[model samples]
Target: MTAGEALAAAAARLRAAGVDSPARDARILLAHAASVDAARITLIAPEDLSPDIEERFVNLVSLRAVRVPVSHLIGEREFYGRRFKVSRDVLDPRPETETLIETALAAPFGSVLDLGTGSGCILVTLLAERPQAVGTGVDISEAACLQASANAVLHGVEARADLRKSDWFDGVEGRFDLIVSNPPYLSADEMQNVQPELQQHEPRIALTDEADGLSVYRIIARDAARFLSPGGRVMVEIGWTQAQDVCAIFDAAGWQTIRVLQDLGGKDRVIQAQMAEIGN
Candidate 1:
């Protein structure tokens, strides 16, 4: 089969499977199978495909046909203009989460902690961007910690970042100037409504709180004060409708100066709060 032939077959299969933008996905996968860029796929799509290349393309199509996330199939995901390794054990990084990084960067901090730091996208990116910063990323899955560590090395920040396996704050110590997270906040119903690629491919523990969707926030809100220094800040990525509820959690936890920021879509997506001092 030629590249064009492979593309046609993959597109047809993806479309039948109800995957959006079948042609676009087909082109990307084809490029990967052919060892070329997506843009270059267009130029040589009519060219003949080797038997080995055709076999690889077929395997990728099979994976995508079953609703596996394209990023997982590709083995890497781009976040904040950098690529991070991803696995079934970690949540794939999304563009919206990059907003969390930008928000954290806006405030100057020497040390950072990334809670629920699946794939290390936020922590690694933060350490990469802020040279003087040292950070640690904590995740429940050991596999995720390994992947995050590998990505830290890939991004040339391994010396400044530590990846560890912990159930939230269980194994973590020391206070940080800034703490951030993109925790699982999707409600059960929300999980059901998620796209198949995400629902089937991504780790459930990294996507939903497995309860009413407030579990992670509750834990983070209550524990953050202990882990953050006086005047330290915490930023969390939240579901659009979750801003007020999350803010209330922080307030109840005694965190002050609670503020929510909106993403590009005008939805309140990040809630930032400062831990108050004892005297004040």
Candidate 2:
């Protein structure tokens, strides 16, 4: 009936459904239903649910109980301190991917390429952070490209960001000073271990390549050099245990100066490398 009461009830329902972080999720959903901030949910006194708000809250909680990602329910996720629209069509942006953005920003580049760009969070964030830089985001899913394009517009970087529907480098052209990707790296066996929210709700093409996790990395390793400027850099997010194998892929491709960067959790999160100079 009231905001607090509705939140409490939704949290109980979610908890009973085995949802993790039920209370927190309930608060956020309640705020979305009320069209207010989550922090403001606590300030609303009892008897304020209003029939319409109550109904919306109930529906959202039910969906969340099914393990649908909150980002999809709310239609947005925060990445690199900015909100990017998300959907089942795109991979929900993860905090660990920020490592790739940080690594990209550490150096100066006038152009960037983001393969399997998904929601365009990585490419958009980079272009937003570097006003002079322009970037292209490529995704196999046309819906994902549209979502990423909307996010680019939301971040006021649409003019500098190009969204293309392409499988890896197929439709992409020209060379970039920096190329980055968080491609589908999970193996079929590893896919079985992914959380229900990801395994069931998120797009499978964005999660695993259906074989060894290294398949996408191999493709990137094989094709990235042709799309990269001489001495240009390539950065990719990798599975925690994939540093050695991914590094080997890049090495075999003749990439020079390969290095692994860790996330805040100190996991091997990103592999950065520079293309060998022309004639070298």
Candidate 3:
């Protein structure tokens, strides 16, 4: 079949199975199967796909129809203009997290520490963008640490990014002028209601605290000061409804300069706070 015909068929199947952005997903999977850039797919739309490419595209579409994330199938996800390798072992980097990236880049920091760095998108992006900055990324899951490490290497930031397995700050050391996280902020109740792509394809540990979802924030608020350099700032991506509670957690912990920043969607997506400077 021609590339366009295959995409149309795949899209129809995905739509029937309730996949969001079916057409987009079909186009991307086809590009991956054909070993070409997604942007080039349009140029090939009228061409006949090779036998192997067509077969692979069919298999990818089948899996996607079953709710597997396109990133998991294609093996990479774009974040902050760079693509990072991903799998079921890591949380797919969502566009919302870019808000944290923008806020982090807004400030100048020589060192950064990323907690729960599932895919290393945040840490790697920062180091790649700043060139002179260095960062450490930690995750509780060994698999996630490996994935993050691979991503760091993929982005040519391996020399500047320290990827390791640590539950939050357990094995982390030193102080960072910037601390950032996109921690699991979904509550147990919310988890049950998330999209099938999250519930089935993504790692569960990266999606929730297995409780109220604010536990990680509480921990960060209470312990981050010990790991942050004097005058350092902490920025975190949050669920839209979580700004009030997250801000309160940081406020009560004496975090000054607390500010909530919204995403492109106008939803509260990131909260920035500063530890007490040299003097309060």
Best model per TM-score: 3
Candidate 3: tens digits of C-alpha lDDT, residues 1-280: 8999999999999999999999999999998999998899899999998899999999999999999899989888889888889999999999999999999999899999999999999999999999999999999999999999998889899999998889899999999999999999999999989999999889889999999999999999888988888889889899999999999999898887899999999999999998665322
Candidate 2: worst-modelled 10 consecutive residues by lDDT: 271-280
Instruction: For candidate 3, give the lDDT.
Output: 0.92
lDDT of 1: 0.88
Tell me how far candidate 2 lies from the true structure as C-alpha RMSD in angstroms.
1.5
Task: Rank the models by lDDT, top first.
Answer: 3, 2, 1
The local distance difference test score of model 2 is: 0.91
76-178, model 2: which lDDT tens digit per residue?
Answer: 9989999889999999999999999999999899999999999999999999999999999999999999999999999999999989999899999999999
Alpha-carbon TM-score of each model against the true structure: 0.94, 0.96, 0.97
Residue 72's C-alpha lDDT in candidate 3?
A: 88
For all candidates in order, the CA lDDT equals 0.88, 0.91, 0.92
